[model samples]
Target chain A: MDRPVSEAQTKADLGETVLFKGAALKLDCGAALEDIEIAFRTYGQLNAEKTNAILICHALTMDQHAASENPLSGKPGWWIDLIGAGKIIDTDRYFVICSNVIGGCAGSTGPQSLKPDGSGPYGTDFPVLTIADMVRAQGLLIDHFGIDSLFCVLGGSMGGMQALEWAATHPERVFSAVPIAASTRHSSQNIAFHEVGRQAIIADPHFQGGRYYDGDERPRKGLGVARMAAHITYLSETTLQQKFGRNLQDREAVSYGFDADFQIESYLRHQGMTFVERFDANSYLYITRAMDYFDLAADHGGNLAAAFEGTKTRFCVMSFTSDWLFPTSESVQTVRALNAAGANVSFVEIESDKGHDAFLLDEPEMHATLDGFLKSAAQARGLNATKEAKDD
Target chain B: MIDPKASAHGNLASSRIDLQLIANRVEPGTKVLDIGCGNGALLDLLVSDRQVDARGLELSQKGVNACVTRGLSVVQGNADTDLSYYPDNGFDTVILSQTLQATQKPLEVLSEMARIGERLIVSIPNFGHWRVRLDLLLKGRMPITGSLAASWYETANIHLCTLRDFTDLVDQIGLQVESCITLSNGRAREISGKPSARHNLLAQQGVFVLSRG
Candidate 1:
């Protein structure tokens, strides 16, 4: 029922794609998929003891280029500021592994991948995946490296869901975990937002029942609209007020038309337009659906503590003050469960005006908190400071 | 004497008069939770010296952040509100160091601590010490001593208690005092008999080890 990694194909930007030729990945929905491919990138060297490997789970719309430049956007990695030589994650001292999650289009087996019958892309037919399923696929990639346990499993938002899933399902393999700006389950409001985005994509004229990949025209308008709507949830009213504040876009005054006359409107339009170039519409639908289905406590007899009973993995849960998408109350609920389970856990609510996307931005307080946490965790795990770190 | 190796944690047991006393009563390798653990100095000491599993609940975000930086499992929570979340008898030792006076409801906190911990280590500054009594009697105002240095206007010690008052509450809550120690002018002395006026007047601070009766 399981197989090791095969060097069947290689991909650029997202790194190498390992084909599991005969392995079947069983999903939470009682479905199974075979011939799966996982794309991942590795930074720094795995220590000889192999105890210094750190797995960085990517958020939605992010690829495996965590500390490198992305080919598509020609921009630095999403976490480039925190994960590099002598940085907070400290690539010089730890081996970093970032993989594109299943149902993600960045060189990963997703809706864009071909169907088993070789008819065409799976698209909507791609087996509905869960956060746990994404983590399960990542586990194979971890096994391929012959590492017994990872030093840390870290992420934010949807990626935080994967981190929580990794710890809950494979507690023994995770030495430490940091789930930032996340919750145990998706809220009804979040699910409603996702439904709106899905409806937008499905209603696009070029969608053609999720078979638009072969057509000359893709569902750009629909996917763009979906991205535009989702992008609004990532920011706070304060951020919008301070950054744009009713400012007109390249005009003396408001045009009063449907055009993007305001700066905020133009900004959202740009976010949407750029998103469609690299992301697949069906893939977005699959990823969001997986997140909506994520409820860590549901499978554990409705007790979140039961999921982490007697777990030895250390946890550091964080939230932002302005993050309404995944509020600080959710992190408090998680901390309470960890307390009931008598687990080693820490929780911090960072002061930031940015919303759910604060984890992606450069925050000095967040940086300092993570630096100290990772340093102490590394010391506890007996990971030595690299030569460069020692000098610094 | 201060251990040079412990200086890395900034004075360690000697940093505070009562931290070492609380740390001494905790059994090695036992699960411990320190309520209102400011900056986690005592929790850090217990962790490194006794190798105990240490957790903390800090009221302020700054304190919680500091505790996490030191690798302690700490959450931002209040003593009166957040104690209900922990299960009963979850920790071997629950520590409340110099925080009972500042709590909104001291009795509820004590009862919760008793329920959540098999043994409780509590330290409180005795308000009946001769220095405090004399200062109040002579100055005809609130006392301010080396221990109770904060003025009444700015002090967080709203529910300050004398040694006898604390013991009376302990008995009322059905908690048995396993051992009690008093610190007077940087000296620690164990009080073996029942709580008395003589001990209350002499001791600047009292540290008690209690268990559910």
Candidate 2:
């Protein structure tokens, strides 16, 4: 059963939060949650024909403020470089929609939210949600807009997983998909990394078994360590060497003690310190666990191609050369499966010394690739831009 | 001519000599794969002209980007490594446009291409052209002409061969040539029914249409 979007509650930096009152969401894990709230932001205006809507899914630790300044950090959104008035995603041309995932913090219903029983934060008790559940929830948001289909769905890393899921589960709804720096399933190595990070948060003394949100104390040290570890996976050894080799941390010589001596150490310390101020520890555990459980092919009888058999949605899977976290081989595997399914697909492996984080960086080649793909997809979908050009 | 507004070189149709020759022989409404498709000029032409369902595999990232911007379905992959993944008889016509020699294993690549394609179209620069031979005799050095434009040290044509040599390789691979069009620049002329010595000295380039006998 489903409901409609209630009166929107807008935030200062993040966009409006619409409550789906008495609306039950059936999750992939056999649990149903009623009264769900989703925080989302929109850029550009939906055309009268309603054919120009594009959804930009966010990665782990990213929120719905995709191109705007975040309320917490006051810094420009993660994709500020690739999205704007005349940028690659081109707000001048397409109406872009971005939303905080259900397990995310910024204005969304997450483990940080108070329990319905007025007990406390849901914490570890927040029923585990998978990538499909998140897509199911986002589908409701698209429904609320009265939009029948999306022009394109795109993202990187975990966001890419959501894009892939959106296309596989709702092939009729997505015209095109661009999954970058992502994989069909989370490898065991990735699961290990998440396990390590989860251990960091769970082992923290102040965690009190995931109930750290309302306490006077918080799991700052543990969450910071977790961030510091996960942040390393986001970078390549080449990038770390290039950015901050063996140089000391703004000092002449090494401390030769427990303190951060190398510049790399100092950089990671800063990344971890800044991250915890914005994200919640419990949310981190939930999202990472969801990612670990994400194996789209396994759900469909171990045939990735079967999941996309005869799919009409066009695809362009992009990857970076140095991204060990989600390597080019994985992206190529996706292309091969799409080929087996006879799906319309293209792939590009960008040459970069940067690692998985390259997707979030300013890449001119990526911009042009996306611009061309979306433009062509828009043409095929009979969007206004293509219609006007045809008239001209 | 396809796509009067062409993405390559501002031409109504592709002006490349090799691509022009290859595009003509392809039937309309067939599935095609262009290995080392460069900027996808030929694939784009096939898509717009013959209504061919075109796909491409390019080794250069920039080339792949250019192809994507033109809205061509091209992947960044090496012909040597990536061909093993494609299913057998997946395409009607598989084209190796002046890229067969640069592959690490030419015969192995051909075997794979032959397996995956019902019809194989190969266009090659003949190393045994009279000009290349005359240059070797007179200058006592590697030739650098319009056909073989790059210097030997810098050229990607590592396994350069004459038309006669390729015919022998094709025979050894047990495939029969359906037709052979020998070219000087872009203008094509019919070659003899069987491989002849004249084809080696006269033709600057050759395009062969072949299938399993």
Candidate 3:
């Protein structure tokens, strides 16, 4: 590891592995996992009333290193742009908490975490987790801090799924929820992409049936291919065509062999190779499965409105126009359900060519929308008037 | 003031006479849903001035952004399609301000509005104004006036109509006209003595509050 964050740096950046001892997490398939260590990072201090807490849920591959310095790459956190001292989220104002989900490999109790008895990694022995299970585990972490409710719960993609579930399962806890670039359920195309990635990992001989941790050989090729496929889903065709197009990687002519000739090919290969270094293969399988099975409506007796019936929590549902993975139509359907359920709701279909990953990138309109939404919500909750009086 | 943008003009009501009339009709502490609430000007007026609980549905992102910025609840959605999601009699008053002419199905939208609110508010630009008629007659082409500023080819106002036309539709739909507020050149017009024909010819805008008969 090039940049192993020092003890001082970890404390300074709120990087800590918090194990809620005897943290009992029950899976959707009637299985239970004990001793959950939820790696989380917090920015800003909880107010005296503890009402200014905002829980940020991360996407499929993202960990709890939100708005901090990433220990692995010596770079800023993935969502550093939006959650800084003076950024849209305004860490100076609200106590922001982000936790690595249960099925994650980054210091969380994932399929790759070492068994409690000091055996090898849990690997496939980890019970399958659902989005609700993940939310339930996150609730334990939030409860430990003595926060009765959060100011807001917000996320994009898989993170968005968690935000939706958080509001649905515990409507009283979240005053406002923002679910961006996500839907109530995963589309068939999403499942298809996930299935292809799983198959790629399974096809590798070195995978060793998800028990690759037993030997020195890891499923590098298989996991790399899987990442390559999954990364394409995160971006739009316009982005790829604009970034790479038919440009050659290094030469003027095609290689004519299996070697990468196009710049897109080389880019995907680099993305795949770099990803496998930090992420575990079995954890990827588990997380993907969790995302694939997330259908909020199906769980609520096939009535989407029933999931949010009589919900008093305010919602801001957003989607990018070019995000085909979770299109504008998906957000519209969600807004419809919220309206039918008489929920306080707002929606914005942002015009952008950045696709599903637009929520992570620099979207000025998105920032404005979020800033406006939160500011209004804060005022409604008396957060603004209180802080102003304090300053005065 | 440190920021002039944050200052509320003490007398928030602007020269939009129809808006003033609509604002005057709204009671305190009632629920209001303003469709196509641009920049949330009227909703903000209602919220801050009238103390009425206000919500909004705007079709454009910019509109929704402005509404949210002003601390008003506004969703981005269309009138023709998304109105069906709202439950019946959810709001005391549902206002469609100067947006009736632009709707794909104005009648259907108004019908949905009637169902969603106890009182339905609609403001339609008068296509039968004397200037519009004179311009059409003399120029031999589509007329573009101050209220209907865009060219016929480029305009988003697909179902433009006159005061008489709208009133006829209201009658056809079995709606009782509670009151009619007429405006001309951003000034309120008195319609008590004049006939409906004169109101249709002179008025540039008409704000109507209708109830299902």
Query: By DockQ, who's the top model here?
Result: 1
lDDT per residue, candidate 1, A54-80, as tens digits? 999998899898988887778888999
Overall local distance difference test of candidate 3: 0.83
Candidate 3 lDDT tens digits, A1-392:
01112121123343677665544566788987767777889898789899999999999989898898878767688789989777778877889999999989877788888777788888888888899999988887787677899999999999999999999999999999999999999999999999999999999999887888878999999889999999998899999999999999889899789899999999999999999998889989999999999999999999998999989899988899899889989888899999888788878888899888999999988888888889888887878533343455
What's the number of clashes in each of the models?
A: 0, 0, 0
Candidate 2 off by > 4 Å: A1-13, A116-119, A250-252, A384-392, B1-15, B131-145, B149-155, B168-176, B190-197
- Interface root-mean-square deviation, candidate 2: 1.4
Off by over 4 Å in 3: A1-14, A116-119, A385-392, B1-14, B69-71, B134-141, B189-195
Candidate 1 residue A271 Cα shift, in angstroms, is: 0.8
CAPRI band for model 1: medium
Q: Give the alpha-carbon lDDT of every model.
A: 0.87, 0.84, 0.83
What would the per-residue lDDT of candidate 2 be over residues A1-392, giving only the tens digit for each residue? 64654556777656788878777888888877667888998888788878788899999999998998887788888898877777777786788999999988988888987767788778988989999999988998898887888988999999999999999999999989999999988999999999999999988999899877776988988889999999999999999998988989878987779789898988999988988899999999999999999998998999998888878899989999999999998898898888777677889888888999999998777777888877777777776552244245
| Per-residue accuracy of model 3 over B46-160 as CA lDDT, tens digit each | 8877888788888767667667766677888888898999988888999988777778998899889998988887877789899999999999888877666667777777898
Worst 10-residue lDDT window for candidate 2 chain A reads A383-392
Model 3, A28: alpha-carbon shift in Å? 1.6
**Candidate 1: which stretches are off by over 4 Å?**
A387-392, B1-15, B138-140, B151-153
For model 3, what is the alpha-carbon lDDT of residue B175? 85
For model 2, the DockQ equals 0.51
